[model samples]
Target chain A: MKSIKILERLLAAIPIMIGVAILVFLFVRLTPGDPVDLMMGSAGSVSQQEIQALQEEFDLDKPLHVQLYIFLKDVVRGDLGDSFTQREPVTDIIGRALPATIELAFGAAFFAVLFAIPIGVYSAVKQNSITDRLSMAFSFLGISMPAFWFGIILIIVFGVKLGWLPISGRLDYGFNFPSVTGLYLIDTVLARDWPALKNAVLHLILPSIALGMQLLAVLARVTRSSMLEVLRQDYVTLARAKGLREFIVIVKHALRNALIPTITVLGIQIGVLLGGNMIIETVFAWPGLGRLAVDSIFSRDFPLIQGVVMIYAFTYVIANLVVDVLYTYINPKITL
Target chain B: MLEIKNLAMAFETERGLVRAVNKVDLSVAEGEVMGIVGESGCGKSVTLLNILGLVPHPGKVLSGEIMFQGEDLLKKSKKEMRDIRGKDIAMIFQDPMTTLNPVFRIGEQIRESMRIHGLFKDVKGGFFKSARKHAEKDRAVELMEEVGIPSPETRYHNFPHEFSGGMQQRALIAIGLSCKPKLLLADEPTTALDVTIQAQILALMQKINQEHGAGIILVTHDLGVAAEFCHKIAVMYAGRIVEQGRTEQVMDNPHHPYTQGLLRSIPKMSSKKDRIEPIPGGVPDLAELKEECAFYPRCAKAHDKCLSQEVPMFDAGEGHTVRCYLYG
Candidate 1:
């Protein structure tokens, strides 16, 4: 029964996927830019014939319907087309960058969950205390601060002034770490390069913290409110009256029930974190899909833009689906 | 055995300090069933929660001594209270639907109290922890069966929501009795259930009270339930016990006007009349309470003197007490 529901959800996603493809295709094409002029290196200096030849060669000369037909056909064949500027398949470029983005997303989410839950639970348990007030103030600051501004501040403080860590890039030059997962930290560990791993982590800290700040704030607030509400429940009162330890009453009885809504917020935060990675990646000079999208937009790389949009939409859909599945596990009463 | 003396619990509300429970004294001997009967906001439930030390935030136990089995529970630390709570005293809430944790299975919840009090270690001498777990599971099933739950093994694994209201109350009772507590405080356990389910749950509770020899404090507004189930009945009015006596005496000859009103409100099966007599006025606001009789405004037989001076508990008859100026 559960598998059938999962299948139904997957089937429901097809129309959304198609809609994203058409929207991305039209949006990239309708934007005020020309890939032919970009490829010429000097706009209007190149002969009209050169531009025409480049357009014809890249099939940009085709009509909208014909182009969409060809794009959809290629998409059906598991092909996302090639990057116009790099002259390589968009899939291959994305595969290399995808690992970095995944690592950042997971790392930021891990950090947020690690600190947010404890802080939230503590704040709720000690509600109206000075600690609760202070932590809530910090959460407000985190929520209100933009990732771009936060990232820059981190860089200026830790990189420029303190000179404790690298200002940009995934790792230092001349490190020969094996590329196992394409994520530098993992690759360094795989190759047993301790210094490279340390360098990779040091680089990850600022961007991850900046990227996770909003998510952390949201998670903490949700967890706090959820816990406070759950703690008021009769079950929690009964658990306490049952003579269970305070820790068990709060954690086992209260937290487990409280976590359901927090998990939903987490899934949404994952998608938002991925979106924030665009600015974060650009700020850190990190090679990820969001940065690639930014670069593609500048150069009018239609295929790359469309591919990145499609992937982002796909990940968002999957994240929500995964959260729904997790909801069933956390609360068995939830059928879907 | 449980004894409470001068227990005054108050809540600081926006209006003012509302003394929810006022100078309440109660005692229940071992293996006895005592019922606290009152209308809503009369502090019946609050008195029970204060005994369990489960009063919610903004509420304080002003001055009280809850002596249970020779020790003062009020003087004990929170940690000590926790130790006494499930092992020695357990409480069942009013709403069965919301009382049990929805995320956990019935069997697990039933076993939780035992696990918390380390009943397995006491029974098994701390050997074969895995086997002890299985034994506990077996005991949980046994408890489910004991509470009259059908197909105990199968129903034990079900979540709280999967069970009906009556079944959920049974599961709650099962959990309450898991550790063999010497005292059980049930606060309107059947209020949320239908008439038939209410009867079943009451019967189940009565069975547990008899079989386990747990001193049960049943809090309810229904005088019929109190008369049927409890050995003694204490009628509360605005946080004070207006009248208390053995169940038969209280039922036969209610002394205080409030207790008399409560008995009159119960729908008699033999009566051909369609409408039952409800007490005239609502319970007085705890915030506006004064030293005079709280039931003065609502008492059908209130005299001028009843509104002027404080009414204290007066010995009316053999083993019966009534808090009224008329009793003097």
Candidate 2:
């Protein structure tokens, strides 16, 4: 079963890579920046020989189709090449930045699901009541406000005004950790660095809130509507007739069934989040792939752009594949 | 024995308060099968839902009482009443398609009520706790097999979609009969099934009743089914029972005009008739029927008196009753 899913993801990514390669090939030529001039420093006096050499160095002078072929071959071989702006391997930059976004994404998703499931369940169970109205109102506000905007609001309220938490990046300058895992808090905890862990938590709080708040709204509203429909099923009446406790009826019977759609929504949300991270990473000044991709696109760094788009596409495919497996487990009737 | 004395039910609607079941008196012996026959919206199912305490809100029992085993059930709290449901009194709904949870394994769904009705509430020994869950599964499998599943072991993990329509109804029956409740309310259990499956399910119900002595309230619109299985029957109109009597007598010699019309309307296989009788109009509006005999507007026998005044129910004979101006 696991192998089947891996095979499915591999198949899905192939088309996505082809589509992305075409886009990267087209967009790089359309953009204004001359890679040769940028590399040679337009501010200083440079010869045509130097310009031609630099263009050939990165194989920039190749025809569009050939360039696409080279990029595809390198991508398949797990080579993302050097960054035009950062002057480092694009993969190393991505590797260093991934944990920050991952920490934010997982933390936010965890918090969202933890709070949303209960709130959605209660709002659905107590539908048309004051509690339901309140949850609906809150969810609307959460979804409507952009995460970056929400982050700014949080920074002002919690960091600037209330002065409760630190405002920006992951760690305090002096803080050190044992590099056991890439995650800051986990590494600090493994190293038994309590102060570093505290600093990590403080730094992660606002970004987590920014991400968690949006997913919380999306998941809760979905949970509420989905549960409302699920609760109407005759099985719920059967559950009630059986004399199971109300909570048990909702949680054990209804919620899991309701989660079928919500699980799909979560997987889709992950895809959306990967794309939205460009905005989030920029706003929070977090050195994640989103920031890297944004800087690469601005500099017309075609190779880096190709790598990021393909990776993001691949991430989405894997997430959907996982959701598919989960769907099968939740509903035994599902064939694939 | 379960006895309902002067039971009245009303729904608070947008227009006004409408009485659904009015001042009704009924009793079922420990081992009797009673049928409540009525057209749609005649409150037969609602009455059963009321008795089960499964009636939706804003639809309330206005007055009277439901006594189950010498205890007034209406006065009991939800928590206390839950203990009685599916343990002492179980119910199977009309549509088998909707009856069982679609997402659950057939065995798991069967054991849900079993576990909740305190089927495993007993057996305190430490060794028994681990064995009890397994015992519940064993019992579920046995019930499924008893209901005539081809292979209980393989089918136990299968869901509702895996079962045929007949099998689904049978599965529903298996679930209802699982705990062997003292009273079972089967509301239109055969309505959604085909004629063959319907006959099979009706026969199954009769078998369960004769073997287990589970008193049943078979709420259905089909007088033929009621005539065949139920000993006594209640025929309702709008929201009230217009005629009720022993099934043999009622089907053979129906007293009320509404009852007579309903019986004549059925297409009988024995009769060599060119055309079956068709009752001309639909059931009366429930919200408008509180003022008079609900069938008055449609009944050929109706007069000015029938329109102006409410017709009270009268005892016609031994355990027989009819509500009409003629009887009144």
Candidate 3:
């Protein structure tokens, strides 16, 4: 039965993926700039004949339906088409950049959850105490600030004023390191370059913080309310009556049940984090899919935009699917 | 085995400190079943929760001496109270559906209470961890069997949601009895069950009381169930025990007006009254407490003097007591 449900989810993702592909493909064309001008490096700089030749070279002269049909056909053949901007295949660009995005997004989510859950649980247990009030106040402040703005403020404080860290970018460009898996942190370790690894980590810290802080607030608030609700549950009271330690009662009994709803929210937050990364990556000059997608959009790289958007959509669907599967493990009462 | 003297518990609400339990005095001898009967919010549950140190926030035990086996439980530290709970004193709540953790197997939950008390620590005169685990599992199965669960070995793996409501209560009862507590406090143990299930649960509690010799404090609103299962009854009104005595004495001759009102309200099979007599007026709000008797506003026998003076418990014959001006 569970396998059937999983199969159904996989089947459901197909139409959604197709819908996303069609939308991104159509939307990229509606934008003002033309890829011909971008490829030529300026508008009207190249002769009409050269522009026409270039259009023919990439099949940009073809009608929308024919282009979409070719795109879909190529996608089926495991090809995302070549980048109209980068002069490399879209797949190769994604392969090189996807890990950095994954690391940033997952790292941000990991940081958010690690701190938010404990803060939430403690706030709930101590409802009106000073710590609860202060954390809640800070969460409100966090919610109010846009992530990109926060990223800039972090840059000002740590990057410029204190001069404690790099102002922007994923690494010190002068350093040479192995490119295993295209994720600098892992690649540095594989190369056994400790200094480069340290440089990569320091560069990642600001961007991850900017991306994670908003999510942390949201997760903490959700967790706090969820925990408060679960703490009042009769089972928690029963745990207390059983002479279980206060810590066990709050953490094991209450927080375990509390995490179900928090996990659901966290799943949605993953999608939010992916979207927020675009702005954050732009500010920090982080090399990730968000940065690549935005750059592709500005360059009118239709195939690249569509490719990146499709990947984002697929990731979101999978994240939600994972959360649904986790519900069963967390609470046996939930069958699926 | 247990005694509560001059217990006053209060909750700080917007209105004021709402006194929940007002200078209440009660006791239960070893192997005895003491029933505390009252309407909802009459402090029956609060009294028991206070004894368990499970009273929620903003509700403070203002002053009290809870003497259990010569130790004043109110004086014990949080750690000391934890040691006493589950091992020396166990509680079964009203709704079994809500009380049992839904995620855990019934056997694990039963074992958890005993595990907290380290029941399996000295297993077979050796502290082998695996041996202790095996013994606890076996004991959990035994508890399941003792509570009349059929095929205990097989049912031990079932979650609380898998069990029927009656069975969940039985599983909870098994947990309560797991550590072999000297005192068992049950708050409306059968209120959520059907009549037959209620009877079965009551019978099971009776068996536990007799077989294990655990003193039981049965708190319920149902006088009928109390009469059937309890040796003595304490009738509460407005957060105070208005009358208490041997169950037969209280049932045969209810002295306090509120107690009489309660007795009159119970539908009788023998009598053919067209309408049951409900006690007039709702209970007074605890916030606006006056020096005079709280029952004065609702009492059918309230006099001018009853409105002005405080009422005190006046001893009647045969260990019976009534808090009323008539008795005073």
Q: Which candidate has the top score in TM-score?
A: 1
Per-chain TM-score, chain A, candidate 2: 0.91
lDDT of each: 0.89, 0.82, 0.90
Interface RMSD measured for model 2: 1.3
In model 1, where do residues sit more than 4 Å from their true spots? A1-8, B122-128, B272-274
> Candidates' DockQ values?
0.85, 0.69, 0.80
Per-residue C-alpha lDDT of model 3 across residues B238-317, encoded as one tens digit per residue: 78888999999998999998889988998888898888999988988877777689999888888998877677889998
Question: Which model, 1 or 2, shows the larger TM-score?
Answer: 1
Q: Lowest-lDDT window of 10 residues in candidate 3 chain A? A: A37-46
What would the DockQ be for model 1? 0.85
TM-score of chain B of each: 0.96, 0.95, 0.97
* Cα misplacement distance, residue A20 of candidate 2 (Å): 2.5
* Tens digit of per-residue lDDT, candidate 1, span A295-318: 998999999998998989988998
Q: What TM-score would candidate 3 get against the native?
A: 0.95
TM-score per prediction, in order, is: 0.96, 0.95, 0.95
Measured with C-alpha atoms, the lDDT of residue A154 in candidate 3 is 96
Write one digit per residue (lDDT tens) for candidate 1, span B157-242.
89998999999999998888888999999999999999999998999988888888999999998888999999999999898988
Could you tell me the lDDT of residue A173 within candidate 2?
95
DockQ of 3: 0.80
